[model samples]
Target: MSSAAPLLLSPKEVNLLKQSPTPISILDATWFMPNVARNATDEFLSKRIPGAQFLDLDDVASPHELGLKHMMPDQKKFSQACERLGVTPSSHVVLYDTHSVFSSPRALFMFRSFGHQNSSVINGGLPRWVHEGLPIERNSPSMIPSSHYEPPHFDARLIRDYQQIVENSKLDPQTNPDAEIVLDARAHGRYLGAVPEPRPELSSGHIPNSFSLPFNLFLQKQGTPDGEYTTFLPEQELRAALDNVVGAQYAEKIISGERPVVTSCGSGMTAGVLWLGLSLLGAKNIGLYDESWTGYAMRPSSKIVKTA
Candidate 1:
């Protein structure tokens, strides 16, 4: 297999890494949270999978936009970033991260947003990779200078902003042209207004007419190092969790032929995973609430936050 070959795999498929399959491009796409002190590129250069290369999230994003940290970059910057990483349009991207605990889903989003369908993250990320006893490399390859990686047309409508969420509420289904759905990715307590928020500045609780689907609940229970904080249920478990997560309120919206979804998280971070899961399951038209809870929560006039 060439480095451009596809590398999507499940835990069952992880054994192939031990054999050092050719043609597959594996990316050590590890990223740290904003609060975490370590730098990803420095860590990537220190050690990674045998043929694995570094895919910097910051580099992949729009450098021009200073307002939002890690918001998806525009197409020109996205194309250039991929090209710099030797990612041709034909490249099969497999992302691995230290925070399988978090960033893997974001990587999946970046790939899809760029219209590269042949990309998936390694389950449990690098920690799981090491757990499987796969080959590790310390030497950084001589930098492969970048080349052409053309991008598909920028799909502006594919993403939605805070104002869209407000507009969505006022849409009358019968008179409305196209309907939209909003998914709340906060914990159930926050969604239901039972618990206070992690971000103290924002008001607690979910947006109006939003479906509550806690992102952490999807984590595989066994894989998470911090059991209480994040849990990624396996495939079957995820489906089951989705049933519980996408409860009566949202299900009614979906069944009524309303639009599919636009996921919302505390500060627009974890909802990327919600969108990714929905996308993987064939939900064709979905977006993220870019301002998310922060947008609504911070606003005193917003009608949706229920204290009870």
Candidate 2:
């Protein structure tokens, strides 16, 4: 297995690393849907993993010039944010959240997008660590002075704007046969228009010809109260789940970078979870639709598909 295949670390692995001489930057990237009332920053201030800093997704994102939420910022902005968070180019970042795998993958995506490749998402997040009796600290760690961190030119290979997605959807698969595969990470009900979207004025459905692969399917319950801590499914199960949507043959090709894969969701957050899953499987030609359904559904001219 490639060193990266284990993309996740067990609570024990994290505990053991805490005692090691090597330095690792741990981030609490906890976030919640707008409908969810909890404030992640306040929660982090109350309790968090020792030596962990909070990475506020909403705070570090693009300034929403296009009216989209949490879009990736420019290279300079991202570099400045990393420096503020004490993330050096050599920092080995490990992200975790209160709600299992939900928002950590988005943080991982941000790190990778900003040319920070040495990063991973903690498998089951803070809830799991607490369940396992790992050490927790209430006091916030003092911020290390801003380090000179520089990122390479911003990479657009893993990103897709609304225009690209609109154009790709219009392509005839037979003529433009290699068009990117569009995958939506929303729930089946929302993807099928059977359930109302949490965001007002947005239609409930998916992009035309897009595959519905709910982000939750990639996770398995960790037996926590209220099922708070979920973990990524085993490799075998993950492969099977992915195969169901993209086909086993195509899934292999996608993982090997022979085919293009694009992931999206409500506001581009859970889409990152899908991106992370594909990355763990060694996929290189992956792209994230940053505007996602929030932009797509609101557009009067965009095509939508509600049926499987």
Candidate 3:
């Protein structure tokens, strides 16, 4: 990938949007947890980036039958949706949200999983944008006539389903494939079985054989009402922490190239935070466990092993 391909930018790069001549599109991807009373689409319509269009997480995702929320939709479905949204292969995409949250990165995960390379989440999202008093077009953006889009060759190797983790928990070395790595992005307490789950229907504890690297551990400080998230880790610190978690047998796969990680959280929200941090650290092979704890915890078929 070129140095310019996945342009993860700070406020500096963001301010250059209007100055650049080449086409750049920003996506207002604010979304809420499923249990929340507020809907993402409705919230977006109320206020958003000037000229920013909404990206519907549920509408654009694969059918949710796997017990996972918003898994990657099929290539044809993704392409068609992107085409309708004015997203093209070459367009540089800036994904953002109303709050300084992980919804922006979730959109990045979706587009990348389906083979869109030129997209990234704006650091701090709309909170920062608003704080800076950047122009925000609250009305709908002008839509272009749909364009022909080529879908990425389906990479089944990318996604990790619930059954696969269940299988990994039971099987010995022979059955444990080295091709993919499991990344649990839950809080350290949840991963260690120390804390109770946020959801009641699901049980506690993480998958056996999974490693705990809490997503918030990467965020320098949780953003305050008066401030947006200021990611604080030094480059060296980031490299050291990531090197340790990814140093197992999964090391080679991570070192080989980009796109080798699988992120999972209590449900699926924090996984995006983990994925975003991994991208900032320049880790390769990123993915998300869509079903996450929702699918694993209650499964009578799967085993949950707690590790320190």
Best by TM-score: 2
Model 1, runs deviating above 4 Å = 1-8, 11-23, 63-66, 170-179, 189-200, 223-234, 248-258, 295-304
**C-alpha lDDT score of every prediction, in listed order:** 0.65, 0.83, 0.69
1-308 per-residue lDDT for model 2 (tens digits): 00232467887897887688745788999989989999998999999998888898887878764577688888887878778888777777889999878999998888877667777788989888898888999886766777777755677888898889988887654346578888899999999998989997788987876788999888888686545679888877888889998788778888888779899999999999999888777788999999899988888888887773
Residue-wise lDDT of candidate 3 within 1-308, one digit each (tens)? 11245536654576686468856677887777766788788778778776677888767777765446666778888888778777767777788877665677777777776666777677767777776667766676666667657876666765677877666555433245553556788778878877777777666677766667777566565455777554525556655566677664454446455325577887676788777776666666776777788777767776776654
Model 3 scores what on Cα lDDT? 0.69
| Candidate 2 residue spans exceeding 4 A from truth | 1-6, 172-176, 225-228
What's every prediction's RMSD, in angstroms? 4.5, 2.6, 3.7
Specify the poorest-scoring 10-residue window by lDDT in model 3.
1-10
- TM-score for each predicted model, relative to the true structure: 0.78, 0.93, 0.83
- Descending-TM-score candidate ranking: 2, 3, 1
